[model samples]
Target chain A: MGQPKQERAVQTRSALVRAAAEVFDEYGYAGAGINRILKRAGLTAGALYFHFGSKEGLAEAVMNAGQDTVEPLLESRGLQRLVDVTLVWAHRLGVDPLLRAGVELSLGHEDFADGAPFESRRELMAGYLREARDLGELREGVDPEVVARFVVGACTGIQLYSRQVDGRASLPQRVKEMWDCLLPGIAAPGTAQDFDTGVARGERLGRMGAQA
Target chain B: MGQPKQERAVQTRSALVRAAAEVFDEYGYAGAGINRILKRAGLTAGALYFHFGSKEGLAEAVMNAGQDTVEPLLESRGLQRLVDVTLVWAHRLGVDPLLRAGVELSLGHEDFADGAPFESRRELMAGYLREARDLGELREGVDPEVVARFVVGACTGIQLYSRQVDGRASLPQRVKEMWDCLLPGIAAPGTAQDFDTGVARGERLGRMGAQA
Candidate 1:
């Protein structure tokens, strides 16, 4: 209840979350064990029980924390913001254990409703797309919801292939190319050239994430 | 070998493969155990060893046989054929245990080289896109390989989401919607109206798959 004890508790919880993320990422939800997570964290069972209470609780914590890996792009808007979110997220996925573990856990465990932020992320992107359509940035008759779903779906696939093929070294480039192929379909006529899908801006954003 | 003995051997191998598919589907590649598979099949270890040699070998067998679930669309060509391939595969994904097991094993085991037919499937789809381009189907400057990769990736994501959300009942409709969003980006101007992203054709093709 004291200040120093509260800080220590925070640090312990953080360490447990990190350890759980690593184990879950490596072994998946079914294969991950509580003892292994504790060993990795170098913490006592009492500490884990005090903090997370169970493996399922720890998984929820990881998934909740995963969204924090990529900071919001308050400066960007419309389709540009959507593109930035994915590019920056791709970069972070290469380095962040908690984010990757969150993705793996949500993807591997089909029944867990609060698993990943896929639906929430989809809604967020769809909101931006709606704004884009209102501003005459989107092609006529192009549904924002459909584009949002396709973009999210494409991102999931691109990450999987990039990870399998090259440890995601080419993730930024692949994400950029995905936009290149898709922009024409979603963007208003002759406006596809107005946007930039380059990885440079996203790379800078990712650096900001690291600093934060 | 006598005819009856050879028949019995074939049946034993088939049973082992089916049982392995069930276990791999439920437990994934790492959680799947040889004992569990044997128990499911009501067979002995000798039968498994004689057929698959090891767990890795059984996994390879599952991946190889997974491709056999859908019959090739020899009558269709170009992007239409590509669409047909995905639609039929999506339908089969909901019904076939072997195909779903192969996908789970390949997706879960990142190190397995022969995991899924993703790379091969990409190459195949790219070839069709090339033909489509020559026939004046694709947009100017659109890359076949890029579209191919995106399509494969989108299909993977769609299947995962469909399975998680609706037990894959909506897979056909979702696959069709993916094409609806993508076709405008890939098709030549004015040619976009020529294609059908409907689930009806795919459902018919799925019936053919079942009959085959």
Candidate 2:
């Protein structure tokens, strides 16, 4: 196919995923209708099937796309920073149907046999925790896996709660407060004080690890 | 009209709720069929409707029942202890269909009506945070509402993650670790150490203005 044709195909697929996310967020996985998704995407059923094999396939694609957007924020900043960033991202993204859809998609996967399609998201978070631990940001004898789980759990809780409360509290500020409470217990005794100095100085700790 | 008839009606309704929870947990809110629930409860369709009115009504009943079980735990322990106890309760409950149903019901509400259903849960948590602050368990200047949100968020996150990981980690140990991290940020300076010491002395802090 020529470049123009390829570009159009890619655009159509992207639009479908975006539309699918909105429908899924509003109606959930079971309630979401494939016909509605196709209509919203400005495509027909045949075209959607051509791009994604079935409704489940489309849901998975939408989930995968959201993870792509969220995973990097977790990786680059490390888990702690990821928590902070996600709160800000959630607040900024709140009320936008697409982001809301992404959150619902992520949460709804809890019971899947392959175990939450956001498996990559968990792995990425685990990796950041390992990195954080190796750098001595985590306390001596603290289990990185355990801490990682806690961090992930806390973030999930914050996102859900913030989305529920919406205007009453700032999501970003709530995220920071959570991190502050959590860091002191998990951080090597002295590192907890670093955040007290401010976020910029705290960011430097990620680079100045024991290996550095 | 007789006492026996009233008793039988109550029993039948309870059986239907229990059966509905199991079906809902297995198939999700939208996926669970009323017929299946009726079959499992060994009741006719008329009986089910007489009890719950509709599928949404049935879901609300399931939620109300779970909340009834959960409310006392919240009232007695306040927030921090509630997290600790819930992990224990989940472990004790094991893979019981009822607990699984409760989790599914919660996930189903993810997209429902923005956020009203969660308000009671949020309020119970906030009440604990206020109590903690009054007892000098939390920092003097921290907002009780904000701290409560974080605690709730962390708990929600941990429950979802732990349920996913299943045998990979001990839920109670994970809960302790979360508390370890979170307590420091919220506790009044040096109060955590005192609180830790006080626990051994059996000097529990009285409940804060929790009802508010």
**CA shift at B28, candidate 2, in angstroms?**
2.9
Across all candidates, the chain A TM-score values are: 0.90, 0.75
lDDT, candidates in the order shown = 0.81, 0.63
Which CAPRI category fits model 2?
A: acceptable
Docking class of 1: medium
DockQ computed for model 1 against the true two-chain complex using alpha carbons:
0.55
Q: How accurate is candidate 1 locally (lDDT)?
A: 0.81
User: Tens digit of lDDT per residue, candidate 2, span B1-212?
Assistant: 55798899999989988999889877878789999999999999998888889888888777666643433433444335544344444443344466557655665465453555456666767877777666656665677777666766676677676666664245555566676566655677655544331221111221211121
Q: What's the i-RMS of each model?
A: 2.1, 2.4
Best candidate according to DockQ: 1
Worst 10 residues of 1 chain B by lDDT: B108-117
State in Å the error of residue B199, model 1: 1.0
Best by lDDT: 1
**Model 1 TM-score on a 0 to 1 scale:** 0.90
How many residue pairs clash (N, CA or C atoms closer than 3 angstroms) in each of the candidate models, in the order given?
0, 3
How would you encode candidate 1's per-residue C-alpha lDDT over B1-212 as one tens digit per residue? Answer: 55798899988888888888988988877789999999999999998888889988888888777884454644778878788888888877877889899887777675574324778878888998998988888999999988887777778787776666677888888888888787888899867768876888777787787787
Badly placed stretches (over 4 Å) of model 1 are A1-4, A26-42, A69-71, A110-116, B1-11, B26-43, B68-71, B110-116
**Model 1, position B124: C-alpha lDDT score:** 81
